[model samples]
Target: MTIKKKSRVTSLAAGRPPTARKPKSISRKATKALINTHHVLEKKKAQAIAKGDRAAEIAIESEIDALGGIEKYQLASLQGQRLDRGGDSSHILMEWLNSMDSTISSSAGAHLKMLEVGALSTKNACSASGFFDVERIDLNSQSDGILQQDFMKRPLPKDDSERFDIISLSLVLNFVPDAMGRGAMLLRTLDFLKQPDTQYSSGLRTFFPSLFMVLPAPCVTNSRYMNESHLETIMNALGYVKAQSKITHKLVYHLWVRKSGVQCPPATFKKTELRPGHSRNNFAVVLSGSSG
Candidate 1:
C-alpha cells in the first residue's frame, strides 16, 4: 500500500503546467517606418491649406498693386506734370470706359471739359476720362470757385447745356457726415446737371451724358447714416442704375447712368463684391449719345 501511494504522488507532480516565455523585441526599422508615414500625411495636409490661403492673398495684393499702391492719394500730385501735357493711359480706367455701351467712342470730344469732385491728387481722374479737357475743382478751397454750401443748397446750374458728356464722382460721397445728408447732396449734385426750365431737370440734364462713382467696400460702421447700402439705396431711388461694378484690391467701384428723357432701369447690386485683398477698382459705365 505505501509503494502505491508514493507512485500516485510522483504522477501528480509530473502533471504541473510549464512557465511562459518572454515576447520578442520590436524591430527599429518597422517602428520608424510607421512614424514616418503618419508624419508625411500630416505635413501634406498643412501644405495644402497654406497654399490655398496664399493664393487668396496674392489675388488681393495684385489689385492693390494696380491702384499704384496705398500712396494712391499722392498719385495726382506726382503725376501732375503729366496731367498738363496729357497723362498716360490707365488699364483700370480704359477697361472701365470700354465696358460701357459699344456705340460710345473711346475718345473724348476735341475740347472736353470735366469737373471732378473729390479729385484725389492722382492721375486716375485724368486717365479714366480719356484725358479730356479736365478742370480739377478743388473742394478743399474756400473761395468762389470752391464748392460751397450755397451751391449744394441752390437750384441746379442754369447755363451749360450738355456741357459735360462724362462726370466722375470718386471717393466723394463718404466724406458726407450721414446718409440723409449724402442723399441730399446727391440730389443737389443731380440738380446741377438738371436741364434749365424743365421738369425733368437734374444735373446732367443738359450737362453730362454719364456719371461714375467709386466708393469704399461695405463694412461694419459706427455711423448709421454713412453705411454703404444706404448710399446705394439712395442712388437707386434717384433713378440711377448700376451700369458696371468691380472689386479690385479691397476697393469697390460702381458706375451709374441717367439719360435725359428715358427712365433708368431697375437697380440691381452686382454680386461681385471686392475681396479682402484685390489690387484695383476697375468699374465703368458708357452712355452713347444715341442712347438718349
Candidate 2:
C-alpha cells in the first residue's frame, strides 16, 4: 500500500526560538528517512551490480532520487539553519573562500555591497561566519545586523532601480520544492544585480552586482543545479553569463554576471543527469580523486 508523505512545511513550527529542540527533532526525522532510503538503495545497487542487472540498478537509482535533496529541504525548512547547511559544508566553503582571497584582493577598484538571502537567525550569517561583510536577510529568522524580508514577497530590496554589489544564495535553491519556484527565485536573484549598462571592463558596474549560488549535492532533478555547467546557457537565456564556477561532490557553485543590452524570455529544462561521485553526506567535500 502507498503511504502518505509529510508536507515540507510540516517540518516547521511557528513562534519558537531558534534554539528549540522540538524542531531539531523534526529535522532528525527527515534525516532518518533519507538515511534509511539511502542504505536500502546501497544494498539494492550492490545486488544489481552482482547480478549484472543494469536496468534494475537504474530503476533503484531512480527510487533513491525521490529521497534526494529532502535532507537539505528539511534543514532549510527547519529552525536555526546555519551557514554550513548543518554539516561539513563549512570546510569546503572555507577552502573556496581562501582560494578567492587573492582574486578579491587584486580587484583593486572593486567594492563589495553584498546581501545574503535566507541568512538564518544565527550569530553569524553565512558571509560573516567567514568574516565577510555580506549583509544577511531572512524572512523567517530574527534580524541580527541584517534585514528581515521575503525575497519573493514584499521584500524592500525588490525594486527595479535598486541593486547590490554581491548577492549570495547558499544551498537555497534545492529547498524549493518545484521547478517554477526555483526559476522564480533565480529570476529574482538576477533582478538584484546591477544592470549591465554600466558594467566595467575589468571591474564592477555602477549598479549591477555579481552573484554566488551554492547548491547541495543529491539535488532534486530539474532544479537550479542544472545551471552548474549550462550556467552560461541558462544565464545567457536570462541575459547573463557565468562569471565563474566550482563543482565538487558536495555542491554546485557559480558566480554570474549580467550581459549588456540583453533581455531574455524564460527558458526551461525538464531533466538533467547529476554530476557523478555522489556525496556521502549533504555537506561532505570529497577530494577530486578521493571519496569522502
On lDDT, the candidate that comes out on top is 2
> Relative to the unseen true structure, what is the Cα RMSD of model 1?
30.1
Per residue, candidate 1 scores C-alpha lDDT tens digits across 23-139 of 233344443343334333333434444578766556555554554432332333234324443332233345665444232343333344455565444345454555455544543
lDDT of 1 at 245: 66
Off by over 4 Å in 1: 1-93, 99-113, 125-131, 141-155, 194-208, 219-232, 260-292
The segments of candidate 2 whose C-alpha lies over 4 angstroms from its true place after superposition are 1-111, 121-126, 129-133, 156-161, 199-208, 220-232, 261-292
Residue 253 C-alpha lDDT in model 2: 66
Span of ten consecutive residues with least summed lDDT in model 1 = 283-292
Candidate 2 per-residue lDDT, tens place, 87-202, comes to 43333444545555555557666555567776654444344444345667765554456576677774545553456666777766544434455656767765666656654444
Best by TM-score: 2
| TM-score per candidate, chains pooled | 0.44, 0.53
**Overall lDDT per candidate, in order of appearance:** 0.44, 0.54
Candidate 2 backbone collisions, by pair: 194-207, 194-208, 194-209
